[model samples]
Target: MSEPTGVLTLRLAGPLQSWGAASRFARRATERAPTKSGVLGLLAAAQGRDRSADLSDLAALRFAVRLDQPGTRVRDFQTAHHADTGKSMPVSERFYLSDAVFVAAVEGDRDLIGILHAAVRSPVYLPFLGRRSCPPSRPVDLRAHPSGLWKALEAEPWQASTWVQRSRARERRVELEVIADLSAGDGPGDAVRDQPLSFDPRHRRYGLRSVHSRAVTVANPLSAPRRAFVPTQHDPMGLLED
Candidate 1:
């Protein structure tokens, strides 16, 4: 089938989201910033796929995130207790947990929309904001542009405004205020469309509160296919090159 296109707006918020990175050792886990792989994995689960698929169609899709109330990173230690042997051992471990909100915007082919809709309704996989496995606070949909999306996001009656900041490494900080005001009637979609999906620091705080914006790309898994029983490296290249 020809490639499908659409946009996905996911709102992520919870007490803790665990995106592991550089974790090795038993009972050891490390939390890293959310990545395209982890987010896609969650989407695939909604589709009932336990394993990753070739979703290359999502590659060209634009990705962006707006973090609301960027939370601090915390690490905890774990120790082992032997019940039968009555022995105690100290074990060191590291991981990350944070309470923050995420707004993700994805734009792509129409087929992608159908998949997302189905995934939301009867998700083969559970949906999560970060790692909290929390159901989306609102329905996910495809809109014309960021303004349309902002409208939908604000429409939620329970929406609250807040200030947020994100650390770009451990040094610099970007600040902004975000407010829930979709009623202002942002112009037609075309004018704001194709804005290269960037986080606006000026609009950082939602109302008087601030939030963090973490943008990521969603890769398409179906763009390239390998020949039957061929060595992986020997597979032909550029079949999808336009």
Candidate 2:
């Protein structure tokens, strides 16, 4: 298979994005950065995959993002009162989720693009732009990028920003917009398919790491071009592997 090239843009913004860090209790929450695992979970949902699968395919892909702005952090305190005295008790520490927007771009094999398209079309689970509770304001299709991914995200026509800001006074966060371009090989067979690209283990923490902050054009360095993959009924999940 030949290397493919294209861009995958993700816009993350909402009143809350729970990226569990050191979560211990059923309702336990943590205050930390976004983790790669958490971001992958969102992607899996977009593809409709509820259970974990081999993410090796994504390992080869180059991921980058621009943090439009910083985010606000707030903690919700919980506590119980004395049973005999029935007095007010001290509040326990439960962190409220942070709010921010992320713009990400992925450039790799064309086969990867096909798989992503399929994931969005008939996701195994309810896909969300960032969090399950915060569904995308628009259909998450790259074709909707005539105005660019950043524009699409800003056009969500929802009050997500308002809610995010109102959650906490000290929660003053930043707003960022991203623009990415990708190029991959048009290879044959499934050689590039299901192969893991660069996968971020930190995604479960502070969201996807910001790689290559400065915008740079990507080039495909393959001499022999490969053919793109054609979908088959028996191989519905095969795309995810690529």
Candidate 3:
């Protein structure tokens, strides 16, 4: 008999988040959606794993994320000086998504999922959105789901901010995007170089993985009733007085 599997979901929301898969040198870039390697790194951090710790087990978990609120992409410049030499360092350009909210899920063994669920609530190290400076706005752990990745994502309610939810409620139904890993024997989806191999700072490495994207529609909980329109009298002549 084989062990049953479960899904663990996380809410990644903050004022600022930066998930860079290809950042290098003095420039730091971020992907529109959260990366698999980045989410696993967060899990490793929750378990108090070191940078050089073994990640073979964590790498095997299937990953997926839903963009509850695809926030705006913004850039900023940073200036600093080297401490040891007292010399000014090159200005760095960094990009981040402001006011973003995402739902990340990983399907794996039930025991491991349970362990991770506990670790997140009382993480050894506090969880951050994507960078050390950008911490999460809410609790990351959404608990474990009995269903797999897709169902779990679909079942999870919209996690956008109240303002965003109200703005979106104009539509009766809203569609949210989902990006998920392709399993074996699946069709060739888009390939991305964000899979984690090792997190060793000296020699960090990543492999290629295929991901497929789709959208799921959910009824707007804040959908407001349509208001009847009434014409105001003499509004056209009011501009002449100004």
Candidate achieving the largest TM-score = 3
Ten-residue stretch with the least lDDT total in model 3: 233-242
lDDT scores of the candidates, listed in order: 0.45, 0.46, 0.92
lDDT of 2 by residue, 1-242 (tens): 64536556555555555555446653556333344444555566667543445565554555444443236666666778899999977665665445655444444566675676567666677655333545654344432233233344443332234444344334233233332222243222211111223333533222222222232222222223446898766956777994
lDDT of 1 by residue, 1-242 (tens): 75544456666566656555334575445333444444555666677653434445443454444443455677677677888997887686655556655555555565775666567666765677545533444444323332333443333222112322212222132332332212234332212112112123343111111223322222222223334775566536668667
lDDT of 1: 0.45
lDDT value, residue 3 of candidate 1:
55
For every model shown, the clashing-pair count is 46, 53, 0
TM-score of each: 0.49, 0.47, 0.90
| RMSD of each predicted structure | 23.3, 21.5, 5.3
Instruction: Rank by lDDT, highest first.
Output: 3, 2, 1
| Candidate with more favorable, higher TM-score: 1 or 3 | 3
Better of 2 and 3 by TM-score: 3
Give the local distance difference test score of model 2: 0.46
The CA lDDT at 112 in model 1 is: 72
